[model samples]
Target: NRLLLDLETDLFATCCYVDVDMEEGSAWYVRAGHLPPVLRHPDGRTEVPESEPGPPLGVIRQTDFPMSPLRLQPGTILALTTDGLVESVEVDIEDGLNRLAAGLAGSDPSHLGLVADELLTEANRSDDVALLLMRFDGMDVLPSRESWTVWRVPEAVRHARRYTRRALRSWGVADHTDAALLIVSELVTNALVHTDGQVRLDLTLIHRRLRIAVADNSPRTPIKPTNIGWEATGGRGILLVEAMSDTWGTVPVSGGKQVWSELSLD
Candidate 1:
């Protein structure tokens, strides 16, 4: 609706959204009259995944945009760009796409900026251009696992804080120890207090973020408290987590709901 409103205001816009599945080695994409995504394989072969483009936004009303599938192989680099990156009034869109592919095909995948620079040079860029690159590293490595605990009520909160501290240390993210431990404590406390069964605390450390999840047996959701009172005991727990966490949310799984929070490493 918001996009349609922008189009109604006479702002011509086109976009391409791609959701990559690293594990499955595929991506589901939507091309809204923008350039189709290009996949550069390991063997220096670049190809654009077939996609039907819709009319540019603001040109048509009540348009239906279709999704397309893009399969990714190991060591493949996916390039998504706005038309300016590959198209101009003077150059044919297909030729521009070929130029982008050729530029990326021979370039090293690690340094993506060079590929973009080369493509821009070939394009003789006159308009604004936005380029996004994704290189899918092979999924051959073993997954990492961490220890977690299950407990009920107040006991778990203390245990969670201690466990969180140790986990942060082991992950070499000791800098976030204080804040992350505090955030984990609050989330675990909420799970224990609200649900019946034992609260399961899970922590996973990714490349960019540290994720902490507290799962309980009850389906009830944790409310984000607006009014916080550090002095007045209780009820400001979720608010504290929200303040400390980079991002937080609740997910309802098979047995119950899990309240999770993430803290960025950088």
Candidate 2:
């Protein structure tokens, strides 16, 4: 678990990437309101593990963190991030996540270290950022333990729309397709021009809920665009997601951070 000075929200970001191996076939890990990790499989599937995150560190005496047993197999890559990586001045946090995922997909296993390092670069921000990439070898013969893919990139709305749709479909999520697509488009546009590729994206559906996460390498979280002239074209994405989702928030990763949102199924 990691701690962040929530009061000094403007000064710093905490981020981390860790991998611990257990002797058993199944292993359990705990989260205290930390940025949940994205699970990737060799099969090109992606997901955010379902577990109870107690609360961000230092806020309370002790958080009752939930433990989740991960089914480890060969070629499993789990990417975890911090808040400095996603929430930003330009892109909506969610869209930043989409771009991160796109970049992860093209990353090679041999370059796992580079992938984590480049993840921060892709965001193009100065905020403290940390990412952990975990790979489990020999998954094909393992039961229950699967594999997934991750991708990241910097481009315009058009490019985001193309990939978000493909990614959701690839994971067999078709119900709220249009809404997800729109969210991705909005986030991407904000990232390319405003922040330093300072965006991260993750797509996953677990227990019937669709999870979309975007982490920027930036510590600057989104604020309602308040300028009068900004009303029509600005801050609409935040409003759109706030109106369309169940819940959302931000978390400190290692060096910088992350913002996440979720939509419940009909």
Candidate 3:
């Protein structure tokens, strides 16, 4: 709102702004008398956001532009361009837009820089041609990440360790692999060994701290069984976790319990 007021009074120009909410992987944007941006999702989905546009900036002293919101999933692509790119004496803007969308669809999603260059090739010389391409790397997906996967008993044990190790290494927390692999293996093992229903492992990494969490549909909390003698098999995993990890704990969650541990990167 404050931004809209400023745009109305401060300057005379056609522009757009996207304010991204990192946690939600969504954006709030205002298109004040500018061409709408083209959005392409990883699934080959393409769209142009629809919102009522206010007059160009400075057209009215106290203008109010409605800000629209949209999801920005990981691997999503956004292409913003000036009107000059589509406006040509020889071509209709509609034709230009169709061409642009087709070009974006055909271009390699992995190499969007090259796609942008190819787009500029079709630009008109009658006015300024400007383009900006953005690809989203959502915090919950990659760069900073999280994952949910079910575990089924003995088979899941190996998979859980492998997944945790690979995910940590992908996060560039190689130092954590030795400790995290052991910790996650323990947690996943406990979840499967004791639980009856669904078992899941959720992994998250943030700011050099790696959190390994396992949730399972068991009402019971983890504890060393008195009858199981402390040997190679008796609750040694938890003991190893306590000694090797920076911190560890358990909490009650809906229909189950969640055990989590945090490892320090530095």
Candidate 4:
């Protein structure tokens, strides 16, 4: 939102942003004076969801782009496109959207590339057209996931470690138990000490990899310390996480940020 506000005086653009969580079988999107996404279900039913959009980018300052959520069942196909593909001088936007949805309802989702090409066969040639299509199949073998909310108490770190250890043991990854526990302790402790609002610890085990995630209501990402002397007592949590996990990163969620680290059990 701040980025769009900064551009309010210089540029005019519309955007539709969508984020999909396959594991959760859900999607969240926000439209900024853009077209609503078209969804085709597994049963061949299609509809343009009723989406409330904010003003076009660079048109308003301090605007709140309210997000709309959608549940994506298995074999659901989602389509997002620009006006060139759906609207023309001869056709109204509403009719164009209906036509697009109808076209999507008849296409085969297995051939997404071909489906995209077919959708563009009737696009307005005078303008640039863009289309993005996604088919959510959901996970065939869902990973084992457990989440625990951390209370604002002194024993939070210990409790986090205990949870991590138990989860790792149950998943048959006891070999990496110590390392996972340490990583969880550091991440949860950092979230408790540095941020406010609710804190949560999540563990996901899929195959031979284990993922540890700590979510907090703050959007500020953890910063890594460049240099630490012998006397330094803090600013090493992120560093420890990096050193212990095969991969680690942070992502923005609905109202907060999630710091996640992945470990390979092999």
Candidate 5:
């Protein structure tokens, strides 16, 4: 939305955004004046999801894009496309959409590339045509996650450390408990001191890697201090988190951002 406003032009665009969570076997999607996505179930069934959509981009300021959630089973295929493939002067869009769904139901999902080619062969190309298809096979080994809401009290940092220690021990990764606790403390303290709204600490164990994530209702990314004097007592939380973990990064989420650190148990 902010991106469209920055353009400052009369031209607007439609969009369909999707976010998939493999661990949870679910996805969230929002359509901005775009066609509903088509889904093919594992049993060779097809249907278009019915979800409300927001206005086209650059047409509304501060518009709320409502998201719809879809639970994905193994072997489910999701298809997104532009209206050019389903709308033409001679054909109604509803009929065209039904034809597209029927085509998907008959195609083989094992060969996605071939399926895409076959679908495009029948498209009405008077305008631009685009297609995106994804098969959700799901994760073979799901990660174990534990989350704790950090209160805005003085004992928040200590409580976060204790939670991390317990989770690490339960996951049989207690050997790295000290480092994990330090990372959690630094991250939780940073979020509590610097950000606003509810703060959460999440510990995830997948295979032999452990991921420590701190999420808060703020979009600001953590800044790494370039220099630190010997007498400096603060602004070292990010540095400590970086040094303690193999990799650390931040990603934007629905309402805010999540800062995460990953350590390899190997």
Candidate 6:
């Protein structure tokens, strides 16, 4: 069970505790005035369920805190964090959650610490951040098409875009071809801007959408521009990606990071 409490008074503080059941991987958790945790599957799916929480502890006595049970299946990832880690006064919560979900899907659990760090660094706004990531093992890997290819430099972006187009078509998502191509270009450009390392692009067609991910040996993740004015001209790359992409985010890897974007066929 994971318990988290957030106090918003003069003394801003966050508290968390974890209790695991030996009989099963399921846990009984509770939240109090804190953001709910998100769950991710090994196959790159993620979500944040509504958490029925009580009033913040210390703010109210005799509060009835409801306990939520979460069963961890093999390859299931459970992530909990405070608003300080992901909240943006200007960005919508739904967009933030979508990006967070994508990041978890592409993140490597072996580097969970780095993953949390990257998330906070990208979205920090002068508040303390805390995160908890728990993953289950022994799950079956989803079956995917064995088709793949490699490219170098400028060719990588164009080649990957073509491959994405084909993959999306195979998934009956031909309409998303253009969006996938643009997303691939943006991610590849970001990679090139930061490093000259070998960039690997992976395009996965699932359901009716195309999942475009670019992996590079760079640690930095994209951030929305803060210096907004009539003459603001730079720092809109991520904004465009977010506005155009169905969803997108970044996952920290062993030596680099994988930034991903999703586009729907319809």
Give the 10-residue window scoring lowest on summed lDDT in candidate 4: 1-10
Q: Output the better candidate (2/3) by lDDT.
A: 3
Question: Candidate 6, TM-score vs. the true structure?
Answer: 0.44
Q: What would the per-residue lDDT of candidate 1 be over residues 1-266, giving only the tens digit for each residue?
A: 25666655767778888888766788899877788888899888989777788777777777788888887788899988777776777778898888888888889888877767766676545777777888898576433446576666447677778877887787788987888888877887777666787677888876757888888889888876667666877888888888888889999977688888888888
Instruction: Report the lDDT tens digits of candidate 3 across residue range 1-266.
Output: 34545665554677788877777788888877888778888887778778877777656667788789889888888888887788788887777777788888888889987998898999997798889998887765443666767657457878877777778777777775888888887888777777788877888777777888888888787874445554545567777777777888888889688988888888
Model 6 lDDT on a 0 to 1 scale: 0.69
Q: Arrange candidates by TM-score, highest first: which order? A: 5, 4, 1, 3, 6, 2
Residue 136 in candidate 4, Cα distance off native in Å: 1.5
Overall lDDT per candidate, in order of appearance = 0.78, 0.61, 0.79, 0.91, 0.91, 0.69
Instruction: Name the lDDT of candidate 5.
Output: 0.91
lDDT of 2 by residue, 1-266 (tens): 32355454433322222335533434566665566666666776666666666665555544465576777656767787765686577866566666667667767766688878777786646676666677767423321221122234443456556666776677666767888776666555554445564455666666567766666666666665544354465667766666667886667655445656677765
- The regions of model 1 sitting more than 4 angstroms off are 6-8, 58-61, 140-210, 213-235, 242-260, 263-266
Task: Residues 128-162, candidate 5: write the lDDT tens digits.
Answer: 99999999998889898899999999898998888
Model 2 poorest ten-residue lDDT run:
141-150
* Clash count in backbone of candidate 2: 50
User: What are the runs in model 5 whose C-alpha is more than 4 Å off?
Assistant: 1-8, 21-24, 61-69, 88-92, 121-127, 229-231
lDDT of 4 by residue, 1-266 (tens): 56755755576789999989989999899999999999999999998999789989877776789899999999999999999998999998999999999999999988999999999998999999999999999998889999999989988898888877888788788888888988998999999999999999999988788899999999998898899998988988899999999999999987899999999988
Model 4, position 98: C-alpha lDDT score:
98
- Per-candidate TM equals 0.63, 0.42, 0.50, 0.82, 0.83, 0.44
**Model 2, residue 47: displacement in angstroms?**
32
